[model samples]
Structure formats: C-alpha cells, structure tokens
Target chain A: MKEYKLMKGNEAIAEAAIRAGADGYFGYPITPQSEVLEYLMAQKPHERTGMVVLQAESEIAAINMVYGAACTGKKVMTSSSSPGISLKQEGISYMAGSELPCVILNVIRGGPGLGTIQPSQGDYFQAVKGGGHGDYKLFVLAPSSVQEMADFAKLGFELAFKYRNPVLILADGIIGQMMEKVQFFDQQPRITDEEIIKKYPWTTTGKTPNRERNIITSLYLEAIVEEQHNRKLQEKFKRMEEDLMFEKIECDDADYILIAYGSVARICQKSMELARANGIKAGLLRPITLYPFPSKQISGLAGKVKGILTVEMNAGQMVEDVKLAVMGKTPVAFHGRMGGMIPSPEEIVSALKNKLIGG
Target chain B: MTEEIIIAGFGGQGVLSMGKILAYSGIMQEQEVSWMPSYGPEMRGGTANVTVILSDERISSPILSKFDTAIILNQQSMDKFESAVKAGGLLLYDPHGITKHPTRKDIQIYKIDASEEAAKMGNTKIFNMIVLGAYLKVKPIVKLENVIKGLQKSLPSRHHHLIPENETGIKVGLEMAEKIN
Candidate 1:
C-alpha cells in the first residue's frame, strides 16, 4: 500500500529506472532531456545503490559509454533530444550490432536544424527507420501521457534486457514538463554487478582470471560470416513481430476505427466520445509499440469496422503502417496536423462524422 | 455546455497556479478539465497565463477558439484577452493594476481591487486566487471544498505554508464579487 505524491516526468523516469533494475546511466545534457540527467545526478545512485551514473562529454561519448557498460552485461540507459539523438546513431548501431541490452529516451523536438525547443514528433521516421546504421532494429515505445511516461520506463528497461537489445522511449517536451498522478513500485530489483559478470562470462572485461579470451566486434573479415550474423539478428526480430500491442477503445460496434498513437491518441479518445454521442460509432487503435508494428490487430479489425482513419502529430508516418496492416480490406485514410501542432477534438469529430456519413 | 477560462498576469500574481487549481477543482466536481500555459520562452518577467476547460463529458481539445469567461489581472492582460471572451460571457477585472476596463457593456464585468485587498491581507500575489474565487462565485461550476483540496494537492512544498492566505484571498474575492455586481 505504498503511494507517492505527484511527480514531474523526469523524476518519474529516474524512479522507474531504479525499479527496472538498470545498473547505470551514461548520458549528456540536451535540451528537453536534461531533466533525466538532472534526476540521476541529484540522487547519485552510485553512492547508495551501487548503480553508476556518469555524464559523458557528448551524446556520442555518452552512448558509447552506455555501449561499454552494456557490453559488460550491465543494464544501462541514456537520454537525448532530436539533435543529440542524431549524434548517437553510430554508437547505437554499434550496440545493436554487438547484441547489447540498453534503453534510450528521446524527448523529440522540431528538427533538421537547431529548430525550436518545443515538442514535435518529427523523429518518427528516424527512430523507426534505423537512425543508427546497419541492419539492426530497436524496440521503440511511445508514451503520450505523464502517467504512461512514468510506467513505460520499467517496461522499456525490462524488454531491452530480456531480448538483449536496445529500447527507445519516444516522448516529447509536453510529456516531459507535465506532472501527473502515478503509482510507483516499492520492491526494487536488487541486482548486483558481480552477478551480471558471472552470467555473461564471455563479456570482454579485459583478461579474465579463468576464462577463454572474449572479443566483442561487429566487423567480420569474411562476407559469409557477416551475412550469417545478420541472419541471426533478423530471425530474432521476426520473433518480436508476434509480440505487438493494440488498445481497443469502444470498438465493439464501431462504425469507424481511428488509428493513432502517443499524445495524438489521447486527443482521438475524446473525439470518439463526442462522435459516439452524435450516434457515430468511432473507436481507437493505439499502437503502443511502434517498431514491432501491430499489423495483425488492424488486420483483425478489417471486417469488424467500416473505415480506418489515422490521426497523427506528423504527416502520417504511422498511417502508412496502418495501411499495410489493413491491406485494402477496408478503406484507410489519414488526417493530421504536423510540426508542433495538435489537432483539436472538433476537427477529429468532423473527420469521423464525414467518413461515417460516407463523405 | 463546454467553456474555456483564461486568467493572465505577471508571474508572482498567482495566475498560473490558480488556473491549475480551478482546473483540478473542475475535474473533482465531475467535469472535463485541461490546464495549459504560455510557457517556453516567456517564462520569466514576461506575462504568464493559463487556459482552463470545464465540460460535462470528455474534453476533445484543450485549445481555445474563444473563452466562456475571462479574468484580467493587469491592464495589458485585460486588453489582450477581452476580445477572446465569448459574447455574453463574464469578464472580471481587478482595478488594482488594470487601468483600461473592459468596454463591452453587454458582457458582465466585476471590477475589484483584488491585489490591493490581498496586500491589505498581507500578500498581493493572491490577486489571481481572488479572481478564481470570484469566478467560482459567478460560474458556480465546482464546490468550495473541491477547490481547497485541489490547492492542497497542487501547491509545491515551498508554497504550502501560504494555504491560509490563499483561502483568505478566496473569501475576500467572493465577498467583493457579491458587492461589485
């Protein structure tokens, strides 16, 4: 029966990390994502809990530091915004190639240049389409509300460690600053660094006392060897495709299904309520996991619903995924407002009503 | 019916804090609520304001096309927000800082020296709380008990001690609103 007072998004992330059995945090300061560093620095998990927290020189160095810690079989994490995330792609690619477990939270912003400091879902393509190089994939988790922001950190960390892969937390500035009521876990995961080292005896920890030499490298001199390694990565990724997420809200008798995610999904929830009041059966299909893309769930909805409409904060990046999922069994359409703008409830209602009346 | 409420003023004038309190109170009293701010670059020294919504059902959007009510803390804020209040909606202005009163005689205006009165009560920053108190007097959207609970939950640790003063400001505001109309 333990409860915590209200918490800011960053503070919640810090607490969630400790609960998720993360061994360390290696990060640098970046706008909109600095609070994550601030939380770990203030608490200094190294002193009390034996967890390491170090601020690196740059995003690249920080992510590389994460790579080093993770290579040693430690559960580690780092955070950055759009610009800094762009810088960490090389390190992320390396980690993915080496099969290391970690988490990365990207509090995205307006992009390309040193855009504004406000929230923007512009990093959707970069996050999903391999921002980091090579033929590796990252498990991406997008949280829209402050409540989800706190809870998903635990899920992200656990999933990453389970699969021995990296998980990305795609959040925005609004979700960062906004405070909300969240329940926290008290039974902390008491994991020791010695135990991780014992389990991962093959880790390259520099001349072990009693073990064969271990070398962690992504480069393979022979093409056949590298192709074999890539085939292994692909096989593991295909297994993850079955573990997709789909949230159905008031869709039992839905005349139309609204597909969206993150904060935009919260907006669509309200739109569904209003549309229903006016006798338009509107429901929601929120993909909590963007990368493992829940195609089967949407495929299941083809005959049960009439139409599928996508509402997004970007130019319908996820809408394309929805289209692939439904595959012309039902007409799939898109309505969106991009570049730091949130489409309102009235606009979504109008869109749904228009489609419901066969507009 | 859906309604949007905007209260704006200087940072220390309690505009942002009270806007949140009123929004939470609206939620407790079983209405849809949203609290938005004009943050980012305009955080310090510049004007701060919040938009609050109260509806019977799910709130579709938090943006404001027009407000059902407006509470002005300063002359500048009054001039800026007066145009956005919906027709026949209530407009409350504090004469303590606002020089240019709202012009429309069609809309209801409650002119009170809330800051001066709060300063007389030992703090001038409660001007926004006074406006919120007066707002509750006019709109009657939520109960007094709910508003008090919301304040207790929202007030940061540093400002928790001023709860009594906030309640006094609310009382004075309600009294002023009753007389000014």
Candidate 2:
C-alpha cells in the first residue's frame, strides 16, 4: 500500500532517514532545522528500528560522533544549519580523507555567520567546492521540494556508500520549513553487524585471525603517500560525473535560460511561466546535484540560448559555475538576495528582462 | 484550478495550523498543496503568517508575492496584505482587534467576527476554525466533508472529541460572515 502524509521538509527527512535503515543519527539542534532533530527524538527511531538517535553536546561533538559510527560501517548521519555545518567541517574533512561513507544534511540558514534563520543558498561554495581543509569534495544534492527532501535521505546514503565519501543534502529554510504531501517508501531493515563486516572490508570492526586488522584513519605520514591518496580521491570525484542529475524545462527553443537550484529553482519555474506568458521564450535549468554539477548540460544549452540568468538566494555563488560552463558562448548574468531574502517570481522575471533580454 | 491564500495573524491565533488543515483538506480532495509559513522570531509572539497554495496543477513556488485570497486576522496583516491580493481577488478577515477595515475597491471584502463568536462559544481555540469556515463559505475550494476529514487527520486521536466543537464554530462562522461594500 502506498502511504502519503503531509509533513514539513525537516520532518520528512527525519522520517525518511529512519525508513532508509539509517543505523544512527547524531546531531545538535539549530533553527530552521532543529525540527529535524526534534522529529527524530520524538519518533524515537531507537524504539522503532533500533536506530540510535543522540543529541550531542555540540555541533563538533555530533559530527565526530557520526565520524566514529561511520567508520564502523554503520549507516550514520548528522544535520545542522549553516553555523553548525561550519563547525562540522573538520570532522567532515577527516571522514572524507579516511574514505568513510556518511550523510550530512545542511538545512541552510542565511550566513556569513549566523546572518539569519531564514533560507539562503550561501553555502553553495562550501558544499560543492569543499568547506574543510582538503582537496576532497562532498557529493552534494540540492532538493527543492519536500518530496525530494524525503527521497534524498535514501539516495544520500546510497551515493555516500557507493563513493565511500560524505554526501551533503544542501537544503534551505524554505524547503526545510514548508509542508507538503510526501509519499513515503516502505521501511528498510537496518544492516546487521555481520552484514556490515561482510559488505565493508575496510570497516573498523573487531579484528579476527582470518583477516588483517581494518585500520580507519585520515593520517598519511609520507608526503608521497598523501599525494597518492589525494589523486585517488580526485579520480573518485571525477567518476561521479556519471551520476550528475538535472532538470530542463521548456529549453528546446528557449532564447533565454534561467539557471537555479534548491528553493530558488522553484521560484525560477514560476518566472519561466511568467516569461513565456509575456512571449519572451525563457526556460529553466535546475541542477539537482551541486557537486557533480550539471556543467555539461549547461554548456550544451548555452549554445542554443542567447543569454542565461542565474537566480539564487545567495549573492551570486552558483552563478560563477554557470559562467564557467557557458564558457563565453552566451552572456551570463546573476540575480540574488542575501541575508535570507527570497526573490519573488516577478522579481526574477524583471531580472531576466533587465539583465538578459532588454539589457 | 489554483487558489493561493495567505493567512496572517498573531502567533497564538492558529494561523499556521489553519493553513495546515486547509492543506490537508486539499490533499483529501486529491489536490496538490503547499504550505509555507513565516517561521522567524516573530512566531514567538508577534505576527505569524502562512502561505497555502492548492491547485489542480503542480505548485511552482511556495513563496509568493501576491495572493488570490488574503485571510487577515489582525490589523498588521491587513496593512501588509490588503494590497497584496490580486485585483478581483477575495479579502476575508476577522474584525476582532482590527480598527481600520479593508478598503480595497477592486477586491471583494468580507468580515467574519470569529474571535467574538469563539468567545461566545466559550472556546477561543476554535477561533481559527470559525474564520476557516467563513472563508470556505465564500470560496468553497474544498468540500466540507473533506474539511472534517482534514480536521480528523490533523488533530491527534485524543483531541478528536473536539472536532464537533470545531464544526460548530465553523457553522457559526458560516452564519455570521457578512460582506460590507
């Protein structure tokens, strides 16, 4: 039987995490995303699926807890808002270097530093370009709707395990706080201890006589060894291009293109409608994955479109990527609002007219 | 059909929950719905508002600048959203704490004294349901049966007993709503 329920994006992620057979969740509460932790605590996944849900002392503690659990091959995750995410960078870097799989959710609030509790995509660079001190990338998924919020919980884990790297779900406050109907998938059973040992030979399980001890550490003492590790990580990231996801709307004969992601993408959809109604022939390109960016697709579209406009909730972060992809083939412009202000559909249309069409 | 609504009031006035119930009602009627709330510090005690969109088609943006209907519960919301309604749209409001009324000539304006009615009914908690009832009477976007089912779905089992009282509040709202040109 298909089950559907009305839920906030934050709540949906928590419920989906449990349904995704997550072995443990370690997180500290922070707004616009505190509901993620609150929902998990209330649902008591510990009682339901024997999934450990712990409220750590701080963001630093929570992320390290995820690091510890993930090293054991347990399906573990942690969530936070922007400031809290900043605190988790070191742990994330360590995990990435160690080649451990884990999920991290950033229900991003406005920030250069706790700027506001409102939604913003300011962490685009931090997420896709790497926030921590390393030459590693976090496979980033940006979900624009509550259904995607629920769907990505499972997908995040799968991609994380597949790449043996941290996967970040970069959502904003609008997508986090908004409520919509979500059809849930069937609950999956938690991976057992024996299964974890069998599936992950690199996991730091108990040492046995039959196999060598599984060591999990980010430390590479020799310079050459570290360089080799870095090269291997780069190769892994390069292969992730095969999994790039994106959506194109009305782009077949579009003269102008609007590129956006996450919550801003939904606004751009309305802008596309408004533009078409005015006989402007505009289209929208929404990138679902921020790390394995849809650069190839954007480059392909750039030749067909006369101009492109990038709309975001931050101050022109993703626009840089769009420009790089277009490669001077078409004029690229940026329209954004910072400190948690959201651009309306009309505003985006005006921006398109002013920056791309009329200008 | 698409109906974009904004419900705004003080924090304790059930603005968010009213939008939630309406979204649930839309779901009951097999409509696509989105509920976006103003979840800032203002929700602690200041003005709170929620945007609810119900449509036969997929909702594009949850955050909207203009609305098809504006359900104002307080004067601040009235001041803010009165001009936000599209021309020929509907403006339904409670005249409880409001001193100045809606003055839009292009839009249809209706007043429902839900706070007073709920006070008369001895339960101020159902005030929002009264306003919701009045809005439904004018708009009729979702069926009453679906609304009752929505109430059932949104409220916990322990509070199901209060559904009848809420239904009565809705009836009172339906009776008391008046359009003043």
Model 2 bad stretches (over 4 Å): none
Candidate 1: the clashing residue pairs are none
The per-model DockQ list reads 0.31, 0.89
Best by DockQ: 2
In model 2, residue pairs whose N, Cα or C atoms come closer than 3 Å (at least 3 residues apart or on different chains), thus clashing, are none
Candidate 2, residues B1-181: lDDT per residue as tens digits?
9999999999999999999999999999899999999997777659999999999999999999999999999999999999999999999998888999888899999999889888888899999999999998999999989999998999999999999988887777777779976
lDDT (Cα, tens digit) per residue for candidate 1, span B32-62: 5666666555555578877777778655445
Model 1 scores a TM of 0.86
TM-score of chain A by itself in each prediction: 0.94, 0.99
Tens digits of per-residue lDDT for model 2, A109-180: 888987899899999999999999989999999999999999999999999999999999999999999999
Clashes per candidate, residues 3 or more apart or on different chains: 0, 0
